[model samples]
Target: MAILGTSYWNLIDVLKAGGDGIGDVVEALTQLTPFMKDANVITCNKGTKHVSSIRTGLPQVSWGALYQGIAQGKGDYTQVEDTTGFVEGLSAVDTRLLALKPAQAAKLRLMEGQGFLESMAQTMESAIWYSNVQLNGKQFHGLAPRYSALANGNVINGGGTGSDNASIWFVTHGDMQTSVITPENIAAGVQRDDKGEQRVMDGAGNPYYVKEELFTQHAGIAVKDWRYNARICNIDVSDVIAGTVNINALLRKAYYRLQGRRSYQMEKPGQVSPGRTVIYMNKTLAEALDAEGTNGRSGADNFIRLSPREIQGEEVQSWRGMPIRETDALLNTETRVS
Candidate 1:
């Protein structure tokens, strides 16, 4: 019914049945016996992986006693001699012990070479939309200016104060595209990309899945499509800035021209280039400058301060960079069949 005394085979059947539990496999291994001490006896069990593992638990027996079939002798024969045997003999024990090893555990050299190298090619993807957004370099989202429950007050169907409009900056490394989220874009591009299906939306007009929001700039948003060579590292960046930011500025300036308006906010300290939209980037600026493509590092959470010349000529760092490599993680015991 079961191979290797039904325990291992029964374990296999449980595994093959498309489900698993620790109790079953343990019971299987428990029923198996160890190998004989005779070197020859151990050799016989080495042929199959299943039988080899079973022999480890057996009581050790002497090589000559096992094969010669000696009877009780007095001086040393009145009873079995001082020689004690272990599970079928030392040979079987050795074979059984070897069976306990993982198929590749012994080949440490191979795992370090081909295995580790192949691992680097694999990509990990993460989502940025999970948290509050950042625009350009500042947090675009403050506390979600929640409106008190008014029976019905979510994303007011395009009625709030400039709440419906926002531009975003998305960052990710991929093929045919290094980044998405355009200066001309309004909401995230992927939002509301549901094809022919009515995607759900939240109270603030955000898509529950992010790819279903109905923002205008969603069209200009870029994405690294799923592909092989490019190695789909589809890391997502989903912070939104106002697309119509300049629109408000223009409206204010135009109102002044008509001699009837005032400004709400002061222009940022610097040469204000109105020609470039909020999200616009000059290739001159985006061009990477680094000896090994390391480029310049970026800061987050904290603001970088350009201290007075009296203190320092350079911009002082506000925070450290994110870790490029992770620390050693805890080792996981092999619980599943490879």
Candidate 2:
């Protein structure tokens, strides 16, 4: 029997499933960003908060003689509450300008709204990997903070000791693994509300009419099973540029770190099904990887394969059937993760 591939859903999927009217706008806004397009999203059933029960330890199994009594063992579990943060922005355009170009008034307002949407999309992307909820209570804890320690089981050290370092991430998006969360009863993605034209005081204390719109997105990150995600950190940028660091070898290590025999099991008795896994790197590392793919080095040709699959009409590279996506949210100037 052939196993079917996992189908992952993002914020736009959730919105469309719930019959939200802004699905097209959300798709247009996030289609250009790979992270936003591929991230798995879930709606909270507990209003603004969602709680997950994580299995920390497995039950002990023991063999006994016939008719002998055995001690019962229970699995250890912990509950974590994930809260969604509100990201809000206001777009206001001068009514006088709109009046000057009456024929293009709607276009002008739409252009202003596009700016707000683009900014919100970028903010959410950055927050997914770098936001620190402890320092800034308004934001949610991101993947970096959760896997910051090198000793963590899922964090793979790249042995880079410089400041110009980067990381490659392997994320499996699924309901039981990791996903982005939204508040209950709220439409997924950015919600826009037109406040109409209102008279407001300007910076010079002058009164004027301005068209106003409010944009808000409620989102957070949830790592239900942390083992499904892997991070290869501390890759030295200088070495990569000099053709010294072998990204393919690091990727192979990450593959084994994240992929297992149980990952392919789906909908079977006593088996945990896996999710769709994807790789993420910054532009610099992506280019380096491309260079390595065509460098004619021994055993390098078979490592990274350029896939025919197109994401938003752009060709995406792959490694072992997993798509490799590039996003600006990942920085090439990260400090060494020792």
Candidate 3:
């Protein structure tokens, strides 16, 4: 799910590292989704609390002869309630089997634990991506609905209604994108049963217990600035598959707008100045993009689907110098209207 270029942000690791007190549940499940490894994450300390972020509004100046102090422009602040809850995934293994078949049991235990964790991770990724698309969830609102309301200009239809390939790509900078936070007071970690408890096999002593849990909440996708983020909806999959639409051209347009944003020059003070760009797409769209790049046709400069290699022990592909990763969490089936 990873690609060649560097990620704009870091994935939050609640268990080993600290967070902005939000998105701990999802952060703890990073191993399940490789693309999530590149996302910026914050862990907070509460299930539901108001989180504030500084946003710069319009500034003013005056050219006076006497040199009197001009009125200072007060920056804007965005406060949103981040509410997160606990989600737990568990796996168990009998002790007797481990004691009897040392190596085999160890491998089986590792495999089972890994399988369970991967499933949970995918679930978390799906939830986040779905929310980003639908802009509505039980706990947090998503980006699609928020950006769609910004103006009629932001929500571009992919094609006609009831299209089979209804895909969307979210272009965003670090400044105006959605924020995920967790409560600071909550402890996000994995619990392993060292004690011989939850004995599944009566004669086999106790079974190993593993539990992973955390909470998360999402802030509004955009504050006062709406230009930093955009949505490319109603992308016809058939076009790319049939070699009609140019994937690189669409990406260029989105990335161009993202780079041209003027509000909130940086994500945070003392950080890098220029913003980071990301193209959020599902597997089907990603495949189409890959096909567009590798169609064996002329004028395809930024070819797609680079060789798969191990990056930090994880296998991933690359596209157009950016990381072209796949996540099943994104919705391939969507209805868009002109």
Models 1 onward score TM values of 0.12, 0.83, 0.62
Question: Any idea what lDDT model 3 has?
Answer: 0.47
Off by more than 4 A, model 3: 1-32, 45-50, 54-56, 67-73, 93-103, 132-139, 148-155, 168-180, 185-196, 199-227, 259-275, 294-321
The lDDT of each candidate is 0.19, 0.77, 0.47
lDDT of 2 by residue, 89-111 (tens): 87766676566556656765675
Residues 132-216, candidate 1: write the lDDT tens digits: 2332222111111111122221211111232222211111122221222223212322122222223344346554221111211
Kindly list the per-residue Cα lDDT of model 3 for residues 232-336, writing each as its tens digit: 666776665676766666655655555343322224455443444345676767766666667435755654444554445666554433445566665656555
| Candidate with maximal lDDT | 2
Candidate 2 lDDT score at position 172: 82
Off by over 4 Å in 2: 1-32, 204-206, 259-273, 299-304, 310-315
Give me the runs in candidate 1 sitting further than 4 Å from their true place: 1-99, 106-124, 132-338
Most TM-score-accurate candidate = 2
Cand. 1 Cα-lDDT: 0.19
